[model samples]
Target: MTTTAPAPAEAPASRVMAVPPAPAADAAAYFAARLAFHTDVADVHAALAAGAGDFAVVDSRSTGAWDQGRVPGAVHLPTAQIPRLARQFLDPAVPVVVYCWGPGCDGATRAALALARLGYRVKEMLGGIEYWIREGYAVETADGTRQLPPDPLTAPVGTDDCGC
Candidate 1:
């Protein structure tokens, strides 16, 4: 009766599998594919100053707002009416830049989307008209608006940076 008790069953080997964490989605990539282009107010002004190709600049604000003041050569096409008038005023092949009241407004985005839906190459101008004014660019007004004389702080005299 000296038989030793059977050795305790060996515990199953613990499996240490290394599972990698899931990759995060790229926010820019996801949105970039959906949007046509992105341009800041300064870029748009530069493009205009450089005499870039016949791109259309559309002010997406209402008539009253546009009447108050707007980009010198911008065409008025309110966001609400873009779906109906986009193809009529915009060329499908030409690049179009859309802007609203200012950075706080999303009207430009809405207008851009509407133009894009109609097959127009469109970009929403970041900062909108407010930036345009703050940057010292000329704007058209009912009383014959004038561009603020170039100032050294704003831009060097006799330079294109004044956006005259």
Candidate 2:
């Protein structure tokens, strides 16, 4: 007797691609707008390392967090103090990049919003100090500057570039 083959199983529906991608022009505009409002840890580091003084990097976390560890050379301006102290700490003419604790934190966004309302061109650093540390960048602490090995999962090892 000949045996019949089992039927093929159906592929699972993907939540990721469930909706088709936007048209190219729309996607381009969307991404351009996003980039206009955000910068990543690596990009910020590169710019700072290059001695580009065109913009300022602001740490929007609490004092404790700021003292714990922060992006090297970052200005310590917490979200609550932005309104009262931003102008004193940062120049209104220079653009600003704000970051908080990490990707999970919304402190940077708040800081950026406050700065924008005050007429400063601002962009939120996408990953904050946590990502800076994770990406093996040196952080300024009370003791001094320290750097950790890049997390293999988040960044490439033994390489200067993420190859993005």
Q: Whole-model Cα lDDT per candidate?
A: 0.80, 0.93
Score candidate 2 by TM-score against the native: 0.90
Q: How would you encode candidate 1's per-residue C-alpha lDDT over 1-164 as one tens digit per residue? A: 58898999987655542444334566566666645477776667787888887688999999999987898788889999998888788778888999999879889988988888888888888778877776667889888765665545545566655443
lDDT accuracy of residue 83 in candidate 2: 97
Backbone clash pairs for candidate 2 read none
Clashes of 1: 0
Off by over 4 Å in 1: 1-36, 148-164
TM-score of each: 0.68, 0.90
Q: What is the lDDT of residue 36 in candidate 1?
A: 47
